[model samples]
Every structure is written in C-alpha cells, then in structure tokens.
Target: MEYRNLGHSGLMISEVTYGNWLTHGELVDREQAVACVRAALDAGVTTFDTADVYAQGAAEELLGAALEGVRRSSLVIASKVCLPTGDGPNDRGLSRKHIMESCEASLRRLRTDYLDLYQAHRFDGTTPLEETLIAFDDLVRQGKVLYLGVSEWTAPQIASALTVIRELGLRSRIVSNQPQYNMLWRVIEPEVVPLCLREGIGQLAFQPLAQGVLTGKYLPGREAPDGSRGKAGGRAPTFIGRVLGRPLLERVQDLIPLAGECGMSAAQLAIAWVLRQPGVSSVVAGATRPEQVTENAAASGRTLDDAVLKRVDEVLGDLVDRDHGKTAQMMAVKPSWTSTTP
Candidate 1:
C-alpha cells in the first residue's frame, strides 16, 4: 500500500484506509467482520477509521479484537464523535462533556491509550465551536489524541474552525476532512477541496464507489446483488436510496470499457479515479468480505491518465452531484430512541 503525509503533519497514513462503516457489527456478523479486518492488514493497510456512533460502538470492539496482537505503533487508528450515541441530552454533539466522555469511551473500546486521529463526524450547529475546539485541544494536551479532522464540513465552516483555533491560540489546526467523493459524488471539488489545499489540510475520502454503485455489480434492469447496499434495509436505505435508478446505472455501464483499457475492474478504475486528485490523502473503503478487501486494496498507488479521466467526466456528465449545497444534504444521523435528529 502507498502512504501519504496527513496534511502538514509528519505522520504517514496508508493511501487505502480500511473503514468499517455499514459493515462490521451492523450488516456483517462478527466472524465476517473480523475476517475483513484481518484481510485489510494482510493487504498492508495500516490506517483504520470508524465512528463512535457506528453500530452504536460495536465497530470499535470488533476492530480492537481484530488487531489485538499487532504493534500499536505500526498502525494509525482513528474514530469520530459529534453524533448521537445515547438518549441523554449530553450524550451527543461537540459539547465539552460529550467530547471528553466519548473520547474516553472510544479509548476503552479500541483497547488503546490514544487515537492516531480523532475527527468531528459532522458540524454541530447546536454547540458552540469554542466549546468543541477547547475540548479537542484539551484532549491533545492530555495526550489522548494525536491529530484533528472533520467530516462533511463545508468550506466556510472549516475556515471558521481555523479562525477560531487561531483566535484562541489552540494547540493545533485540523489535518484532514473526510468526505464522500467518487466519480459521481464531486460535491467537494468546487469549494471544500480548494480551501483544504490552501490551508494545508488533506482529505480522507469515503465511499469512493458511491456505495457500490460504481462496482459494476448493480445493473440497470437486474436486482441488486443479494447483500449489497442497494438491498440493505433499516438506516442504510435512508442513504443508499439516492443512487438507485436506471439513469445512474446506465451511466455506470458506460464506464466498463474504460476499466478494460486500464486492465482493471470497474471498481478499481472508480477508486483510481478518486486517487487521481492530489489533495486526497486516502480513500476509505469499506468491505464485507475478504475478497472485496483484497480487490479494493489493489487500487492504491495506481494512476489514471488524463484521457481516461476526461472520458469519465464525459460519461458521468449530468449524473454527477457537483452542487456544493448537496455536500450536507443527506439525512441526519440520530440515536435510535431520540425524537430529535442531527
């Protein structure tokens, strides 16, 4: 696997990070999840990312067990906060109490003393940015977190955060922002990417395959593969529903020949397309099976030429979600028991 420096920091992270999002404790059983993690390690993936709210924290437990014997110094483990994890009013968001408590809880569950990177899952408009940054700075001072990041934050929001940190003379600036980026989801390209590049922040992108829509497995007229995200029920349907349609599927079908010319699978070509961008530090790929892990891992360190990239843009023309406004347009995540969502 290829490794890149995370923003301006001296730390190195694998270009293909293994992230347990919809898999692990939710869609796949413990045994399958464990196998997938092990497969990632075998493929030389040293960076692992998850969130406190994923599977309500079972994702962390499974990851901890899977990496029990590996030397901690050799891996870069990351987790996030800012989502509802319980019913209590203080159990979520970026409030000082919640951030501190959530960090401690994540440490205990991950079987580690400090996180390589701790991210704010989403911007919390309900909480003061000062309170959130102060809490994170406190964690850094206390040696519990090594670096900072945010996910799905807008350009202005991220700039506001930097200004706040500078005004307060905080310990550090954000090193990365995690966004859903793929051939179809170019929401970050217009504004967020430019700001990050100028501010010395890197991007750790997720969903490089558009929730498996670019994998060539979900055909236009055929039923979704038995266990794919298109067929997933419960909270998953809330998100994956956006990419399920004949037009999107037909556009994906057009890219198959491009994959053949590059001597790669459709999924690999899709992932390589994301890696072509310079600001992206890593592509966070989630897999339910060991074979999937192996296949996605190979996409790392591969470069796509200009002609292929131009053809990709031509094929995905109007189907791409380039609207900067759509960056945060998805349904909010909430505690299963809470009446309020964010």
Candidate 2:
C-alpha cells in the first residue's frame, strides 16, 4: 500500500486504512474479524481506525487482540472520543475527564501503550476547547498519544482547536480530520478539504463508498442485497439511510457502466476516486470479509483520471448539492446529529 504523511506531522499512514466500525463488533464474528485484519496486513494496510463508542469499544479490543503477534511499529492505530460511553454525563464529551479516561481505556483495549492518532469523534459545545486541547496535550506529554485529530468537525471548530493548541504550547498537533467523503458525499470538498489543505491537516476519509451506495450492488427496483450494508450494517443509521434510498441507488446504477468500462467494480472505482483527491491522506475502508479488504486495498493504486472524475462529478451533482446544503445548515445550528427516532 502507498503511504502518505499524516498532515504536517511526522507520521505516515497507509493510503487505504482498515476501519473497525460496523464490521468488526457488529456483523463479523471474532474469527472473521481476525481474518479481515490479517488480510489487510497481508495487503500492506498498516493503518487501522476505530473509536471508543464503536460497538461500545468492543471493536478496539477485538482489533487489539487480533494484532497481538504483529510488531507494534508495523502499524498505525487510531481511535476517537466524544461519543457517549455510558449512562453518566461524564462518560461523553471532549472534557479532560472523558478524554483522559477514554484514552486509558482505549490503550488497554487496543493492547498498545500509545496511539498513533487519537481523534475527537465530534465537537462538544459543553466543554471548553481549551480543556480538550490541554487534555490531548497532556496525553502527548505522557506518551499515551502521538498525534491528535478531530472527526466530523466544521472548519471553524477545527480552527478554534488549533488556535488553542498554539496559544497553550500544546505538544499534540491536530494532524488529521476524519470526515465522510465519497462519490455520493462530496460535501467536504468546498470547505473541509480546502481548509485542511490550507492548514496542513491531513484527511482520513470515512465512508468512501457512501455506506455501500456507491458499490452498484443496490440497483433501482431490486431488493436490498442480503449481505450488503443497507441490509446488514449500521453506519449511516436513520436520517442518512433514508436519504440514501432509491434516488441514490439509481444514481449509483447510472455509474455502473462507467466502472465496468474501466475494468473495475463500482466499489473499487469509488475508492479510487477518493484517493485521487489532493488533500486526502488516507481513506478508511471497513470490511466484513477478507476478500473485501483485498479488493479495497487494491483500489489505492488505481488512478481515476480527469475524465472519470468529471463524470463522477456530473453523476453526483444532486447528492453533492443536498449534503452540502445540509452540512451548511447543521453547522449554522448544531455541529452534530443524534437519533431522535425510537
């Protein structure tokens, strides 16, 4: 796998990293999880992404256990905070208490002394940005975390955190930001991508296939495939899932011939499209099976030419407009989304 710098930091992450989100602690059993991870490593995927709240941290533990025999220096492990962990109020947010406690718990679960990168799962309005930065700074000083990152953060939020870090002389640098980016979710482009490029913050793009919508496996008027993500995984949940229904599926079908003409699956074409962007340092690809891992890893080296990219832009115009509008509205109000449906 090709390696890219983790923003301005000295760390390098594999271009196609493995993620333990919906697949590890949800769909895939222990043996399958281990095999998928091993498959990734065999294909030279050295970066693995997880979070404290994913499957309530069971995903991290499974990943840690699976990496038992692999040399520590051979991989880059990243996890996130700011999502709820338990019933208590202190169990969530970017406050010092939660950040410190979550880091320790993640270390224990991952069986690693230090994290290559630790990210804020989302911004917390209740906590002072200074407190969060200082907590991350402390982890860097204590040798528990090597780099700091934020996920799903707006440009202003990330800028505020960076300002705090600089003013306080914090050792940890916000080197990366994780956001959903794919053929169907190009919302990050006009703002987030440009901001990261300007600030030298690398991007570890999530959902490079738009929660499996870009895979062309769900054609219009067809039943949702038995094992596909819409039928099996929980990444997008309700609101986004509803948005990804037939309209998006039809758009994906429109691109099937384009992928076929290029001698690739729609999934491979989708992944290749993300890696081709300028500011994207890596794309986080999650898998439930070893073969899927292999297929995604191979997508790293393939280049989506100018013509293909333009075609992708044309095909995704509706989705791009829709998500960008939603993101703008969300930033103007709340920076995060939560389930309101029972």
Candidate 3:
C-alpha cells in the first residue's frame, strides 16, 4: 500500500486506513470484525483508526484483540477522545481530567502502551482551549501519545490551538485533522485544506464514500438494500439518511459509468477522488465484510488523470456541498456532551 508522511510529521501511514466506527460492535459480530481487520492487513493496510466512543469502547477492544499477534512497530493505530464514554458529567469533553483518563482507558482497551496518534473527536466548546492543549501536551510528555490530531474542528479552532502551542512551546504540535470528506462532501476544501496546507497539518479524511452513497448501491426511488447501512436501523439509518435524497442518488448514478471508464468501482473512484485533494494524508474507510475491506484498500496508490477528474466534476456539478459554514453548523448540532455514550 502507498504510505504518506502525516502532514509534516516524520511518521508514515498507509493511504487507506481501516476504521471501525459503526460496524465493529454494533453492526457486525466479533468474528466478522476480526475477519475484516485481517483482510485489511492482507491488503497491505498498516493504519487502523477507531474512537473511544465507538460502540462504547468495544470497538477498541475488538481491534486490539484482532491485532494481538501482529508486530506493533509495523502498524499505526489511532483513536479519539472527547465524547462521553459514561453518564457522568466529567465523562466527556477535553478537560485535563477527561483527556488523561480517556487516554489511559483507550490504551488499556487497545492493548497498547501508547497511541501512534491521539485525536480529539470534536471541539469541546465548554472547555478552555488552553486546558485541552496542555492536557494533550502532557500526554506527549508522558509518552502515552506520540502525535496530536483533531476531528471535525473548524479552521479557526485549529489556528487558535496552534497559536497556543507555539506560544507555550508545547512538546507536540497538531499533525492531522480528521473530517468528513468525500465525493459529495466538499466543505473542507474551501477553508480547512488551505489552512492545513499552510500550517503543515494533513487531513485524515473520513467517509470518503459518503457512507456508501458513492458506492452506487442505493438507487433512486428504491428502499435501501435490505442489509445495507441505510437499513441497519441504528445510528447508520440516521447518519446516512441526509444524502439519500432522490436528487443526490440520481447524481451518484451518473458517476457509475464514469467509474467504469476509470477501471474502478464507484466506491474506489470516490475514494481516489478524495485522495487527490491538496492536503489529504489518508482516507479512512469502514467495512462490514472482508471483501469490502479488500475492495476499499485497493483504492490506495491509484491516481486519476486530469481527464477523468474533470469528468467527475462535470457529472457532480452543483451537487457537492462546498459551504465552509457547514462545518460550524455541524458542530452546533453535534450531540451534547451529556447525551452521547460509548
């Protein structure tokens, strides 16, 4: 698999990162989850991403168990914090207590002494930014986390954090930002990409397939496939519902033929499209089955020429969401710290 340095950091990660967000403990059984992880390894994927809040920490446990026999030095394992893992008031946010406790809990669950990369799952509006950054810096000093990252953070938030880091001379600097980026979601392109490019932070893009919408499986005027994520009846139905409108589905169908011309499935073409962006370091893709893992991993190292790239824009014209304000809107609507758990 193709590997890229995470932003300006010396560490390298596979372009295709296997992530278990909704599928590890909630959607698939342990056996299937293990099989998918194995499939990712077989396809040369050395980066694995998970979050402490995924399946209430079971996802990390499953991933750790799956990677038990593999050489730890050869893999890059990353996880996130800042979401409620319990019902207590201090169970969430980026406060020093939460960050320190969460990192310890994550290390225990992942069966690793330190995380290659540790990220804040979301911006904690309630916590002081300095407190958050200092706490993360302490982790680096303690050797529990090697690199710092943030997920779904706006450009301004990132800039503020960087300023604090530089002024305080923290031991660690932000190396990556994980955001929802795909063929349909282009919100990060307008603002986040430019700022990250200037600051030397890379993007670990998530949902490169728009949660399977770009896979061309959910057709217009049809109920979601019986066993698909759209019909999985948990968080998937709600999360994937926004992009399932008839108009969007119809636009996705237009790209299927274009994908064939490029010698890729609709999903692979969608992932490659995201990798072509200016500051992307990796595309984090989730899977339910082993074959799906293998298929998604193949998108790594494949470059789309200018002709195919232009055709993609022509086909997806006006359907893309490029508004930079959407990032703020998303943060505003995120589940309150008191509401979410594991």
Candidate 4:
C-alpha cells in the first residue's frame, strides 16, 4: 500500500488503513474479523485503526490477536478515547483520569507497549480542552503514545486545542484528524480540509464508501442489500441511515458506468476520489471479507486522472455540496467532579 507522512510528523502510515468500527464483535464474527485484518496485511496495509469503544474493546483484542506475530515496528497501530466505555462517570470523556486509564486498558487489549497513534474519538463538550490536551501530552512524555489525533473534530475546536497545546508547550500535538469524507459526503471540504492542509494536520478520511452507499449495490427501489451495511436497521443504522434514500442511491448508480470506464468498481472509484482530495493522508475503511480488503487496498496507490475526477464530480452534481453544520457531533458526559442530584 502507498504510505504518507501523518501531517508534519515523521511517521509514515498506509494510505488504505484498515479500521474496525462496526465489524468486529458486532457485525462480523471474530473469525471473519481476524481474516479481514490478515487480508489487509497481506495487501501491504501497515496501518490499522480501532478504538476502545468499538465492541466495548473486543475489536482491539481481536486486532491484537490478528497481528500477534507480525513485526510491530512495521505497523502504525491507532486507537481512541473520549467515549463512554462503562457505567460510571469516570468511565468516559477526555478528562485526565479517563484518558490515562483508557490508554492503559487499550494497550493491554491491543497487546502492545506503545501505540503508533492515539486519537480522541469525538469532541467532549463537557471537559475542559486543557485537561484533555495535557493528558495526551503526558501520554507522549511517558512514551505510551507517539502521535496524537482527533476524530470528527471541527476546525474551530481543533484550533482551540492546538492553541492550548502550544501555550502549554506540550510535547504531544495532534498530527491527524479523522472525518467522514467521500464523493457524496463533502462535509469536511469546506473548513476542516483547508485548516488541516494549512496547519500540517492530515485527514484520515473515514467512510470513503459512505458506509457502502457509494458502492452502487444499494439500489434505488431494490430491497436493501441482504448482508451489506445498507441493510435496514443494521448495526450502524444511525450513521448509515444518511445514504439509504433513493435520490442518493440514484446518483451513486450514475457513477457505475464511469467506474466501468476506469476498469474498477464503484467502491474503488469512491475511494480513489477521496484520496485525491487535499490533506487526506489515508482512507479508513472497514471490510467483512478478504476480497473487500484487497479491493480497498487496490485504491491505495491508484490515481484518477483529471478527466475521470472531473466526470465523477459532475455525476455527483449538487450532491457535492458541503454542510458546515455537519461537523463532528459533540457528546455530553458527566465529569467526575460533577454529580447530579434531584
């Protein structure tokens, strides 16, 4: 797979990174999950992304087992925090206690000493940004996390956090931001991409296929794909729900002929389109089968020429519009210092 430097850092990550979000321990069984990870490695994918919140941390354990005997130094292993992992108040958010404890739990589950990158799963509106940044800095100073990142964070939130990190002179700074990006979903292009390109933060774009929406398998009037993520009321109904409508499906079908002209599948076309965008360091995708892994891997080094790219955009038409309000959703959580009383 093709590799790119993560932001201004010296670290090199695979352009087609394997991410297990709704797959392991939920959609796909443990066996399939392991097989998919192996497939990604066989296809030259050296970057693997997961989170403690995924399947309540079983995804990390499965990924760790899948890569048990591989060369650790050759891979970029990443996980995230700032999400609820338990019932208690201290069990979530980006507070110092939660970040520190969560990292330890993740390392144990992943069977690794140091993570190549650690990310915040989402913005925590309840916690002070300083507390979170300082905790991340401590993890780096202690040699537990090499590079820091945040997922689904807006440009303004990122800017504020970076300012605090700079003022504090923290050794750990965010090198990447993961966001939902695809040909049909252009939410991040307006502000997040520009800020990242200017500030040396690269985008690890998730959902290049729009949760299988851009694959054209989900037909306009046909029943939902049986085993696909587009299945009605699937495990990720909330996220995948955005692309299940007929209008978007029709637009996606229009790109199929273009994909045929390019000698690739619609999914590959979607992935290639995201890779062509500015500030995109990697395309984070999840796969249920080995062939799916290879298909995504094929888009790693492949580039669509200006003609194909322009035609693909034209097919998208007004669907390419960006949504400023669609930035990362801020989650609310109760802090350890606060208690609710009736």
**lDDT by residue (tens digit), candidate 3, 164-244:** 898988879999999998876778888889999999999999989987989999888888887789889568877776667
Q: Assess every candidate by TM-score.
A: 0.95, 0.92, 0.96, 0.94
Candidate 2: pairs in clash: none
Question: How well is each residue in 1-342 modelled by candidate 2, as lDDT tens digits?
Answer: 789898877898899999988888888899999999999999999999999998998999999999999999988999999989998989999999999999999999999999999999998999999988988989999999888899988888887887888898876788999987766566677777788898999989988876676787766666667877657755534323443555566677888899988888888999999899879899999987899999999887887789998998798665554244344343243212111221
Q: Candidate 4: deviation at residue 226, Å? A: 2.1
Models ranked on lDDT:
3, 1, 4, 2
lDDT of 4 by residue, 1-342 (tens): 789999888999999999998888778888888899999999999999999999899889999999999999998999999888999999989999999999999999999999999999898989999989988988999999999999999999999998998998887779999988788667778888888888899999998897887888877777767887756343575556555666667878899999998888998988988988888899999988889999989988777999998898787777664775667731222112111210
In model 3, residue pairs whose N, Cα or C atoms come closer than 3 Å (at least 3 residues apart or on different chains), thus clashing, are 56-342
- The candidate scoring highest on lDDT is 3
Q: What is the per-residue lDDT of model 1 for residues 184-277, given as tens digits with 9 covering 90 to 100? A: 8787899999999999899999989877889988787777778887677656655665666777788788899889899999999988998889
Order candidates by TM-score, high to low. Answer: 3, 1, 4, 2
> Which pairs in model 1 have colliding backbones?
none
Ranked by lDDT, the better of candidates 1 and 4 is 1
Which residue window of length 10 is worst by lDDT in model 3? 333-342
lDDT of 4: 0.86
